[model samples]
Target: MFKLTLMPQNLEVHLPANSSLTELEFELHGQESISFGCRSGACGACVIEVMSGAEALGARAPCERNFLASLGFDGEQFRLACQCRLAGNAVVSAVAAPR
Candidate 1:
């Protein structure tokens, strides 16, 4: 099992290694507000900052990479939550919605 820590709110969700971010988000839906649009990584709505265990998440998909590049984000710090699969324990900080 993998422990996902959502920061700012500090909500933690335990999930299987095979679980997708979409599934995790849905599971925690009412507990917290997470910004997300395309579950396929085509949108940048689900980006998060990895606070710990960065190596535990899956690789960035092509769409995520493109979006990240467009935003000039550091590859090591940002991850598209929708594109990342849980592998082990991870602590991530949620990004606030645009004003």
Candidate 2:
């Protein structure tokens, strides 16, 4: 199982390994702060900062790399929720671009 924490809001959810963050966001769509756009990973609307366990997000997709690079956000701490699938537990914060 994987433990996911949404920060500031401090919402925590448990999911199995290989679970999709997009699916989580979809299920919690009305939460307001946990936003999503272009679920295919082409947009940065769902960008998040990994507060801990960044490795749990698995590998970065090509679209995610391109978008993050274009935004000058070259680091492991930042990730697009749409492109992430949890491999372990992780704590993250919803953040805007240039993070």
Candidate 3:
């Protein structure tokens, strides 16, 4: 299992390894820890800062990579929660809405 910690709120969620982000999404539903829009990579509403254990997340898809790049975010720590899956424990913080 893996743990995902949402900062500020410090919400801790546990899930199986290689789990898709749906688990995290479900947990955050209706909460401001991270705001989700399209549930796909196109929207930046669910952006997050991977404070630690970035390896827990899978590689960025081409779509996600392009979107983040367009937003001027070039670091591995920046991610869209809607586009990420966790394979290990991770600590992340919700990013302010870009829109």
Candidate 4:
């Protein structure tokens, strides 16, 4: 399993390896620490910062890369939660940029 720590609020959620954020909608969405929109890469509302263990989230796909770039977010740490999955443990902070 992996531990995903949502920052500022410091909430911790556990997931088995290779889990997607979309799979956690029920466990997460209502939390004020983060926000989700569309649950797809098109909207930037799911933007999150990998506060630690960034490699755990792996790489971004072409569309996600493009969209994040368009939103002025660059680097591996910033990810669209909807577009990412957890491979290992990760700590993230919601930095939502709603569409």
| Leading candidate by TM-score | 4
Candidate 3 achieves a global lDDT of 0.80
> What tens digits encode model 2's per-residue C-alpha lDDT throughout 1-99?
878988988888888889889767555656755578877777678888899998899888777887887877778788888888899989999886564
Query: Any runs in candidate 4 off by more than 4 Å, and if so which?
Result: none
Model 1 spans with C-alpha error above 4 angstroms: 97-99
Per residue, candidate 3 scores C-alpha lDDT tens digits across 1-99 of: 888888989898888887766566576666656777788788787888899988788888877877887887767788988778888899999878553
RMSD, every candidate, angstroms: 2.1, 1.8, 2.0, 2.1
Candidate 1 — worst ten consecutive residues by lDDT sum?
Answer: 90-99
Query: What does candidate 4's lDDT look like per residue over 1-99, in tens digits?
Result: 899898888888888888887666677756675667788788788898888988888788888888888888877778999877799888899885533
**Which residue runs does candidate 3 get wrong by more than 4 Å?**
none
C-alpha TM-score for every candidate: 0.85, 0.85, 0.84, 0.87
Candidate 4 backbone clash number: 0
lDDT of 1 at 89: 94
Indicate whether candidate 1 or candidate 2 has the larger lDDT.
2
